[model samples]
Target: MIRQPFKARTPEELISLLSAVAMAILAAIIVMVLYYGREIIIPIALAVLLSFVLAPLVRLVQRLRIPRSLAVVSVVVIAFAFIFAMGSLLATQLAQLAGDLPRYQSTISEKIQSFRETTAGRGTLERASSMLKDLSKELDKPKEAANSLGTIAAPKAASPKPVPVEVLQPDPGALESLQTLISPLLHPLATTGIIVIFVIFILLQREDLRNRLIRLAGSDDLQRTTAALDDAASRLSRLFLIQLLLNGSFGIIIGMGLWLIGVPSAILWGILAAVLRFVPYIGAVIAAAFPLALAVAVDPTWTMLLWTIALFVVVEPVVGHVLEPMVYGHSTGLSPVAVVASATFWTALWGPIGLVLATPLTVCLVVLGRHVERLEFLDVMFGDRPALSPPEIFYQRMLAGDPTEASAKAEEFLKERSLGSYYDEVALRGLQLAQADAERGALAPDRLTKIRDAVQEFANNISEQDERPSPKVNPTTDVEATSAIEGVAEDAPYESLRVLRKEDLPSEWQGDHPVLCLAGRNPIDEAAAIMLAQLTDAHGLSSRVEAAGALSTANIFRLETAGVAIACLVYMDASSPAHMRYSVRRLRRKLPKATIILGCWMKDIDPAALESLREGAKADLAAATLGGALKLCIEATGVDSLGTGAEGQISKITAAS
Candidate 1:
């Protein structure tokens, strides 16, 4: 008989798998409820999210030796103050918006009519007219038939005395039934009260509560459970806080911008944006529509509507793309796929409230998976991706930078699970915009620092973050001896390229596998999925797209969420194409084993110039072997050899960009 090595599951392993599956099912149900009853879901979810937000402050007050009841009172007062401020602003905006509605609608109608007159416009208008005509015909038939009935009824009423009012009334029991219908609402209110009290007590006696919980888990596993719960609480709290700040900022920016534009209900729109940001994809679309409808109703001009669209275009991106990262770089560690899945699932079960709770709930599930055995798979699938772990990520990058492997590590995150919340639709848009810029080669290197800096800022409170030490170099080193004296030469940019040495390549990259690193305006997120299907396990072609995901722009979000890494760092050189530079720099720095390839708009390229650049980077500047040519190109992009260009020009592109 052959002896086989056996593997034993630990306590944490046992908990992870089972907990994941159970939580996933719960999340699914919650999503279904949210989808079916959005209006009801919103307030409930808002209250729950708010509970988390206020819980901390309540606890802080309690910690100061105040009574828990008093702390609850203090939290309530703060909530009222906040609500009043928001309500007042919202009221003013609504009033103004209402007054301006007719004008905006007329303006939009006029634009539509104008558009109809143009050649392309005419076809679109005709189709729309045909559709509208059909709808009107259908609608008018019912109205006309109903009106005929009304005429016939007039004779009957005249012919016979109307039934006595008392006779028409339903039985007394029916009235009681009507009252019963509202009983459900009353019960929810009672439940809400209980939840509030529960939350406050939990917050106030947090320390004692934790101690009790630790004891309950048993001495053998007490430390582990306590740590897991604490981690969950801390991370959950941090995420909610970051989300709140980001939402508020978006609202303020949108509101102020509308006001400055002289658009009606500017304040209301801003407040609306803020509130709607909490909703997923649907929220931004809705928020934009309200403004668009108002813009059209007020001006009834194509130009005015166009201006409104432009305003949203300019404002939404800055707020979502720029300010969003700056404010809420908190990584909940869920993959984009998992996030969407959870959001969808919870929305199905619990409605919008479920959506809001999805993320936190998922985090709790991940915690539970750490305890239970059956749900361990979920922890692996949905937990913060192993790719994000600096050590593992560093090791992979070191192993001859296999983007496929990097993608795999990132995919590992998908196993961790999620609770879907539409906390930042604007953030998603910003990410899309960044990807578009990356495709166009319009991105500037300076933007990445702004982006990364913003990421760092947004994710400031995250645990286990490495503290970077100020760099200290040896004075006696050959490269440092002369260059160190001049800070400019010695100042190493975090971005890469301008040089490609053997050491810069990793063990995985140094092999026989052919590699293609594609980047463009329409950056595909499914590369890993596609690559995974095509490659063998030995190939190591997996989810690891690069070393860093969100490099210089929120556009990198698709890649970030997909578990893509940035291969290299780039300097802001506007004269150089931003997209190409970013792509090349990334491949140069991040992927040591793989060669970087550029994805470009076919029309935009000057074939002759492209050939020159291609040849310059390769052997004979014209060699045909994929690996050799790629190596040549890497050599050409090496720093020091490529002279610098106008950085201010690059800065402008990023700023207005």
Candidate 2:
């Protein structure tokens, strides 16, 4: 038998695992209780949601010089009266629809006959009947006497005398039968009553309830609790108010459309559409199904059905895409997936009521999760807020070796910000991610290669596609240095090796004094170096990039003779600056006249460690970001390289008459 090694978990890891298990158990218990106690919980949830919707109305009524109780009573009565009146109208329409249903029997029969004719022919039905008759005859063959071929018939046993048995049953009276019939109705009616009373109380004492909840959950942080409660109330109230207006408008449009199309009981279908649409995702389709079916039943020519469908198709898209988004604007704070999942979850827990309440309930959960420290994971998992910022997204895509998407994201960002900002925020962070992975040895050699290749592609392609032309360094001015830089990679794009000519130099900048950007030992370092070069070029500063380790004695002499003024060494993941100190010191020794600035680019930095690194490297300055490094380089060189023309051109051509 072979014995395997057992790895023990750290204390923190163990505690985290146990905490996750406890949370899972607690969640399961909550779900179970919610499902079983829905009879009580559902009404409370409904009351809370309705109160959120109606609280504004109650407040408005209270502002008319009426007592609070009177305002509540008046608002509730008016609301219920409107609902009851609508219900009566619907009942009357339903009765009329029922009476008219028989008139459509001829139409339905005609449709059936048409379908039969289309499927085969009128003779097909008669043929089918004849076939069935023949089948019946064949199945009803008389049974012959048992053949003696393979069986010997046993003699019949003597018949026994029959025994009598008596069974007793109780008859249900009319009252018991009536009670059985109305039991289901009684539960629903009682729940409605409870919801009404709860809504009234909730509106009357909303402030007291809110204070109690804050004290219970956030006594230590009352400000945060109050803010969270206010946010939740405002969001839910706005959602309901906007939703009511949109749905009411939708119903009106539906009614008008149906009435124009001569659909019977158009108002009934309109009300149903408005009500059913409160449920998300599939509600519109379900609401459409009823009217569509009724249209078919009422009309033999299919015109009404077609028109009904067209009306829904047009209105739904217009409202959903245009008006709904314009009004809601991320108000619910539930993601699309979260909305669907919550709908399914709540529907399972409390049936249709749960489905109707899903979005509001989820909005509440998201708000709580956002404000409560312990429940923050819920917001992280379910909220509509972006899970990743643009930079993180770009970095992740690059790590996954998807340059196309990463480039697309970069391009989208470029529409709003400068190219240098994009490089600093997105490209630099991406390189840092690669550096971290490489340092941890989590990235395989081939994967690292792919990531490097992808990032390079993104950088090169995105630069070319920029609407503004990027500054280019003229190779004629310094052929040797340009060749030395360009020869580093035979297939490298121009984005990695552009040099500004004398004509493009800023007024205060000398053509000979360009910045020399050096890459460290890794590809990430080279990527950062390229980013710095791009940024420097954008500011009308001539710059050239080369790998520090790739530089030869001859190349160094050529660069020295090239009259470069600043040598910027970029290191993306130099934890201690041990590897880069030698490069900076060497560059300082070779280019004694030039300023040496070490670019220690990272997302986070320790000031002490950075100071020590700068001191050890014998460099003039150390910066944590590309922007800072560029600033240092500018200050050291004493040049403000902002350009006045397109593509790092500091002077614009004046049109002479």
Candidate 3:
């Protein structure tokens, strides 16, 4: 037997595949360009980040009637001046610290000597030393014999230096000496000059540059381009400003803490800390290293080193975890993994400079993903937003046969939503999925059983998990709630639905006012029926769920005698009204006086088909959601109040009447 080659049958599928391949190639090309062009790119990126930081200052200066160019120049000059001064101060402190290193040499020597003495006996060091000494003595015996033998062997004529040879050396010129001094500074000076020039020009022409970028990225769609650029600018500017303030605060705290701990050059350490922290992840460690090393060198004991370590360990976490979340919220829109991965990737591409620019660059990518259809994958992969909605997640859990997680997800949703809403949004949607799978012949028998059992268990425990009272609905002229149930099953289902046993009517569900919830063909539909019954019971209407088998021709007489005031026929996965119309008509005929409700439980229903269903089935009521159907059931029973103690009141009214 030969196997036929697989092929994409649809044009859309083929196009999608090609697009994915193209995106992969594009991403590779981008990584390569960023790596190779880093020399120029790094400075430009630095300048861009700096512009975000200094734009507000430039605006402030301009507000004072200063020309834009002059404002840009003034801010740049002041910033560079402060930076150079700080560098010079740090150099001076470093030189002094270096000079003081000699004083700690004695302390270091004493500690080394103590360690040696402490490990001298009965240890790996002692054994290693003993072995080395023995080996040396054995080697020295042969060397001594060789020396003795050489001395006995001889006399020879002395060699003499026959002639003097001239060797000329050229002296260094003044220019050459100057060149040597300046060559080390040349590249750095040139780069700094370029950065300053870029910063000044960017600040002066900020709006023009923004407009140019919009044209370059989205010339055909000006509105989208403008929105994307504005969003990116707003987010980047806010992130940079907040980070600067937070880092500055961190540095100030370190300085004060060090001062209280009696460490030298606390101010210098603080300044270094603030600047270095622009680099994420490892920045805090790098900033702490200098202060820790200085503490070790300046103090005669280890107390200062320990205290300095403790300070950073405490401060970094507090700022990173608590302060950042409280202030930034979801403004950055980056996942923690995305943050670290971007840092590593940028660091690899542009070295330390890339690390410094990673967050801003990643933010730009997220914004692009938000606006560009093709690049939406980046947002799904890296942005902090949830990839799957609650209904999708619940349905996926059910498909995977993880009842525990499905129930847990239901409970989580219940925290913010009502149990009825949960039924409509999560439980019913999951059943729709199962029904779809059963239709496609994709769901396994056992897996279907698991999904059914899980959903039923969740419905059964709604009251136990949520202690809140059920919502009140009026008995007459049932008001339709406007809460939209928004989920559709886009994927095929994987399993069959669970079957539910017909629940016995409660004692109070007697006389002429009991509610009957009719389960459809599948067990998943029965789960929905269970929820409706639960709601009816909560609404002061006594209710019971009955399987379809219990209401067949043979049992129609039994149901008629049961004194059920309302019959709610639940169809969670209604493919069409044609198949259900006969069953509904039969139920309607069997209970002529009872109010019949045909509930097509889904996110959406066709209005024409729904009207047809109502006409064909002769259902007195029709609903598209569990909540709607349950509301109709409660209304049909003529229960006015859903108060917690209404059962007792209802019993007393019945007795009085």
Best by lDDT: 2
lDDT of 3 by residue, 359-460 (tens): 878877887787666578889988988888776777777677666776666666665555666666666776777777777988776676666666666555
Give me candidate 1's TM-score against the actual structure: 0.46
| Whole-model alpha-carbon lDDT for candidate 1 | 0.48
Q: Would you estimate the TM-scores of all the predictions?
A: 0.46, 0.78, 0.79
Error of 3 at 68 (Å): 3.0
Q: Model 2: per-residue lDDT, tens digit, 223-251?
A: 87798888878777878878878988888
- Please, what are the lDDT tens digits per residue for candidate 1 over residues 554-643? 534344322222121211111345455554554444444333333221212344544544333321222111222222333433323111
lDDT of 3: 0.71
Q: Give stretches of model 1 more than 4 Å off.
A: 1-48, 62-65, 84-105, 119-195, 208-221, 279-286, 303-307, 319-330, 355-357, 363-378, 387-657
* Top-scoring candidate (TM-score): 3
Distance from true location, Cα of 487 in model 3, Å: 14
Q: What's model 2's TM-score?
A: 0.78
- Clash totals in order: 105, 3, 5
Error of 3 at 597 (Å): 2.1
